[model samples]
Structure formats: C-alpha cells, structure tokens
Target: MGEEPREHRLATPEGDICWFEWGEPSDRPSLLLLHATGFHARLWDQVVAALPSGFHVVAPDQRGHGRSFRPASLADWTANAAALLPLVDRFAGRPLIGGGHSMGAYVLTRLAAERPGAFRSLLLIDPVIMDPALYAGGDAAPVPDPADHPIARRRDRWADAEEMRARFADRLPYSRWQPQVLADYCEHGLLPAPSGEGYELACPPALEASMYQNALRTDPYAWLGNLDAPVTLVRAPAGPREGGLDFSQSPTWTGLGAQIGAVRDELWSANSHFIPMEDPARVAALLAGIAANQG
Candidate 1:
C-alpha cells in the first residue's frame, strides 16, 4: 500500500462533507465511497489502500455526523450527488463506481435510482432496505431505531467504560473483533457529553433513527433497477448495526440475494454490518476484480 493523505472535508451547501481522495486523481472512473450511518470516511482507509494502484478512491462522510455536521437536510443527498458528477467529469466521464455500506448503500441506491445514467454502478454493503413502519408496526415517521431505542440511549456517564464498550460490543454481530479496530471504534466513536461522568455517542440517536425512517419510505429495488450502469452489490453475511439499529428485512437477505441477482454482479461479505471496517481487504479485492471486468 502506498502512503496516502488523510481525509479532507469538502465544503458543500448542506455541510462540509469529509472525504479522502487517494491514488491517481487522473485515473478514470473514480471510486466514490459512501460510509454507513454513524461512521466516517476514515473507516475505509485500510480497504482503500488495498485497491488497485492508479484507481482513484473518494470516501465521503455523510451529513448529520462525522466531519459533515448540522444544517443538513434532504438536499444533503444532492450534495452526495455533487460529490460524484464533478469527480467523474474530470476522468473522461468514466463510469463512476458508487459504493456504500449500510445506510450509505441505501442512499447510494437512491442516487442511482434518482439519476439512472450518471453513475457507472452500485456497490452496497449490508444495505438497510426495510421501512421503519414495518419494525414499528405502522408507527408514524421519525421512528426510533431499535438499538438507539430510548432505553438503550441511557448511558451511565459521559464516558462510561463498561457501559460504552458493552453497548458497542452489543451492537456488533461477531463476538470478537481486531483489537485495533475495536479500540478505534470505541475511542473515536464516542464523545463526552455535558454530564462529564461518561460519554454519549457522537451521532444523534434521533437523527440517525430518522434517516432510516426516511429511507424506508423509498424502495431500493425500485430505485436502483433504473440505474443506467450495471450494479455490483457487496452484502454482509451478518455484524453490529453500526448505527445501533436492527435491520428489519422485507424479503430478508435470502430473498434480496435472489433479487439482487438481477444486477450485473453481486458478492457476499458474510461478516457484520461494519464490512468496510471489518473486511476492507475482501471488499477491495472484490471491487478491484469487478472494476477490471467492467473496464
């Protein structure tokens, strides 16, 4: 892996979108990465490093959290779109590979569906596709996420070690994690609150839950099927919710796997929801192979 610069933030109308551009910027069809809810672009560093040399990779921190905080609206989605067209225009209008994890994948699918011909393909990781109403059994909009459910929001302090680590571990699917990854998640993922005794999560529980509610109203299959470019879905075999929410399935992974077969190609990651953090090498290899065939 070549030494790469740390991620920088892009000034957008909605908020400053945090992103890191690595490899040959002149490379055609840049790789645009969209991370899952509650996480940032830094999570993709290990995976991006393993990508083929000369391939440009741009990973953006979405609205509401990370470096891109506040004043965010649905228009923020447009900013997500802005991150792409200009980048791709610089590279011979090469097919831009739009890759995302969890809610990142959910929003990317919306982008592909919203504009069919603009992007080259879709790469989703353990995407959240079910409507919040399904989980709530017909609750109105702004549904609370299961993990961040009011009860789970009560932390013992501004930085409670036992509480935070336990909750973080509870969110993940696997019983074990790479030591560094686990530590990094715990350190960067939490922030001190006014309480001064323990820490609260950096991402807003209500806002995060609301984003899922907003996405569930839209259908990925309906929206993504309209994409002009082929689609490559990288789904998780299983993991922590990352956003502290359970992914209520519609047809479930079993059915979506069959449905996603309609796409050009689909690879399964069979780990946890935090695929980029957990299995970036595998993802890098899969994406590299697919991009090669498409090229």
Candidate 2:
C-alpha cells in the first residue's frame, strides 16, 4: 500500500484486462480488489493505503473499463466473469481475500460460487445484484440502444483531471466522495482522446450505458448457494424513490445475504451506493478484519 503497484495485463477471450499488484508475494493470503463499473483499478488507492501491512494486494480494471481492452459494447455482463477467470485463477490453490464494489462485487460472487475454494472470504460493498424476481421474467422489456441511453451524452472531453474534478466536485453523489478519492478517479479515469484532441473518458460513455441497459440480464442467484466462503455484505440506503437514474440509490437486494450459504448483512444507512469512495478507511478496516481471519 505504501508504494506504487506493478502493473500487468492478461489477454482474455474478450480482450486484455489490466491489473495492478502491491507488496511482494508472501505466505499470507493474497488480497484481490475489484472496482465498480466505470471505475479504474487505481480508485482503490486510498483503501489500499489504509490496509495493514503484509498483504499482497491485486486490483484490476475489468474489461471495457480503465486501461483494459474495450469491446464496442458491454451489454453482456456475464461475459466479464469468464473474462476475469484467469486473473482470479492466479490466486487459486490457496486462500485469497476478495473485496469488490457494485458490479465488481457481483462478478466476484459469480466466481466464488464457481470455485468456492479459491476465496477465503468476501467483502461485497453495495453490489448491483437486485431482487431475484427481477431476473425471473423471461420477457423483459427491450433495452434501448447504447447510443440512445442517457449516459451516452456524458461529457466526453476534459481539459485534464483537475478540470474534471472541478466539474464533478460540487455535483451530487461525487460530492460525497473523499477529496483524494475523487482526485484519483479523475486522474486515472481519462485517456488521451483517439481524435488527438484533449482527453476522453477511459470507459466510453456508450459502453458504460450498455452495461446499465443490460444490468439485469444475468442471474447470479443460481450460483450463490454453492459458496463455501463467508461473505460480508455492506448495503447502502435504499433509494428515496423506486429508481430511475439515481446513481446514489442502492441496487443490492435486501435478501441477498440470506440467499448465500454463510453471510452477514449490514445496512450502511448514511452512505450512498458509492461506499468505497465515500469511506475508504471504513472499507479498509473491514477488509483488514477479513484478512486477519486468514488461517
């Protein structure tokens, strides 16, 4: 956590996924951290900094986000689990500590269910896994094209990270983030524009929109029962309204913890969906406790 991590990239069927490693390999269980949608691996910098020493931490920018290869579309959410299999497998044959936020948490859930022994425990922060009923309807409403989605209109160009930070600093949801966290997000969230202009979002707006459009397409409940590792779910407050485009509202199902084999559910009444960004120290404390449990 003290020093910058060594960056690595792995090629998958979809494309290459970029990952970062901090600390040297040791006998202690390795820690794997995954970021939420539209976020890069570096967003966890603060959390990692607060973690106790001796952990070999690994964080990845899932496909279609950050420095990872981006396909034209990210409509198939399930494909991400498969894409990250190799990265997760690298920590196999030993106990590994896993922590993820939002969609990252959902992906970890899928992988944990598939290979229960690979994970020693899980810290899920406001996962996007909604009520099981939502996934049951085979005839769901058709999703609009990514270009037609509201997120597609997001400002694509930025003069720099500072400018991006200045714009979002006073905005809702983001305004709640720790100043350093927001700085990290802006610093690592942009890439030089392909047009050789200023800069563009690392995760294209259309691709981000595609992810939301097909959010409920994958059902992870079927695999939840197979998990043998203990899970700690940290839920944010339910939306003030049912839900429209409110990013601050929690999307996690209230019953998610009960569906799993061994789990503890927590309600973070004061926080929004972006728990890690809001309180990295709290997240690090929770993760440190999980890591301490390693035998």
Candidate 3:
C-alpha cells in the first residue's frame, strides 16, 4: 500500500509553496511532480498511489493555485519557474526525476534548462510550449480580457465541497474525470470562503484567467536545447473529439522532441490534453518505467 502524503510548506522568495510527499524518505531516486494551472498537489494522489515503491515523490501546489500563496503579479509565467528553483536546489546531491502537466510541464522544462543537473530525466505531458514562429517578429498573442472570459467570471461560492462536486459532476471536464479523482479535486480544490458561509476555489477565477491570458509570453523553445537530462514527452491528441477543448491544439511544436534531443516522444492518439487526470495509473507506470531505466 502507498503511504499517505505528508503535507508541507516551504517559504521562498516569491512566496510560500505548499507541497505533499509520498513513499520512503530514504528512497534513492526522488520524483518532483508539478500540477497544471488551477490544480493542487493532491491532484496527483491517485497517480502516486499506483506507482511502485522505492521512489520518493514531491508534488507542489504552485503559486496562485491551491493552498500556495498567490503573488501580486499573475501575468508572468516565468515567475512560476523562478519560485520553484529553491526547492530544486534542495535536492542537488540526489538524482531527481521530474515531470509535469501543461503549464507545470513548461515550468519544469524552464527549470531543467536553467539548472541542467537538477533532474536526471523529465516527463512532459502535453506541455503548452508553442512554436516560436507564432510569436516571431516581436509579435505577441492577443489575450482575452479577464472581464470577458468565462473562467474569470465563474461562480466561486458553494455551500460545501459536496455541493461544489454536485454542481460540476455533470459538467464537461469534470464528467470525464474518474469518480475518485473528481472527489479528490473537490476535497482539496476548495477553501473556506471569507464570509464563512461556503467554500471558494483556492485559485480564484480571475487569477486562472490571468494565467491563461499571459501563458504565451514565455517561450520555452528558447531554453529547451540547453537541457542535458534525458526527456520523455507524452502528448495527447488535439481536443473536442476526445473529451473537451483545451487552450492549444497539438501544443508541442512539430519535431520539437528532435530539436531538444528528447529520448522519447510518445503520442497517445486516444487521449486528450488532460491525460494526467484522465489516466493517472498509466502516468504512474510510465514514471516507474523511467525510474527503473535510470537505475
């Protein structure tokens, strides 16, 4: 049986980051898992439970999300990378296995590039790093106004977690998630509302909107070639047909793996961008395989 995750909080220059740990503390190889925007570290609970023993796992609730501190400026995606550096440095002497999904994946790539020896291998699942051509000539992608975006304008207050779950149970993305996964999301995704009447999303709607609006500002392509560790990219097919729509279609640039000298570029034709949440057990097996190969 997998151990229950131990919660922790680490103070950094950017803010206090909340995290959870699983497995033996004395394990030889350690894994660092980063959650996507608006998600928390506990979201990886099922995936951690399914993994093999002998590897320690660390999953952090990134800034502006979950229980972590929200920074004043929510526009810069690179700030997320900067905030995580101190934690990466803490594991300098040990071999680290790093992996992330979506925005988290992009942050891991940036960290690996900035500190080459931080991780022995990387698993990037449907990262949002786009093609440089799209932002060439100093042209930036247009961001939707926060006031106009539905995510920003979402209802935050719910009578309880159960009420929140019931409200979203039949919704598009939540409907696709497994029962336990959806329950975990509800349990950890909400905080007591300020008015003490109900629960509110840990990551406020406007902050999530800001993350999406400024996502394209940082170009991961600029630093991907600098990483020395082996990389494995597990990508899903473009959205709408599989389950639901995502921010990008085939977000990983064509031939990006080759350009970055990645060891493996596996494509799951049947899965959607939310592969981590959709099939966490598969992700666990992949991580176990990667760790075993390194051993």
Task: Choose the strongest candidate by lDDT.
Answer: 2
Pull out the clashing pairs in model 3.
none
Give model 1's TM-score versus the native structure: 0.72
Residue-wise lDDT of candidate 2 within 1-295, one digit each (tens)?
5788899989887788999999977888888898988889999999998888877899999889999998878876777788889998877786788898999999888888777689989999999888899887522657669998788899989989999999999998899999999999999999999888889999999999888888887778778778788999999988564454686779988788887744679998989999999999999999988777776
Candidate 3: tens digits of C-alpha lDDT, residues 105-185: 999998898888879899999887766775463225565566655678888888878988898889867777777788888
lDDT of 2 at 238: 81
Off by over 4 Å in 1: 72-94, 131-148, 151-171, 183-200, 212-215, 237-244, 247-253, 257-261, 264-270
Residue 230, model 2: Cα distance from true site in angstroms: 0.9
Candidate 3 TM-score to native: 0.92
TM-score against native, each model:
0.72, 0.95, 0.92
Query: Model 3 — which ten-residue stretch has the worst lDDT?
Result: 239-248
**Of 2 and 3, the candidate ranking higher by lDDT:** 2
Q: Against the true structure, what is every candidate's RMSD?
A: 5.3, 1.6, 2.5
Question: Model 1, range 70-173, lDDT digits (tens) per residue?
Answer: 54333233444455433334444456787877777777776666556667667766676543334442324453454544523544344453455566664544
Whose TM-score is greatest here? 2
**lDDT of each model, Cα atoms only?**
0.58, 0.86, 0.81
> For model 2, what is the alpha-carbon lDDT of residue 156?
88
- Ordered by TM-score, highest first, the candidates read 2, 3, 1
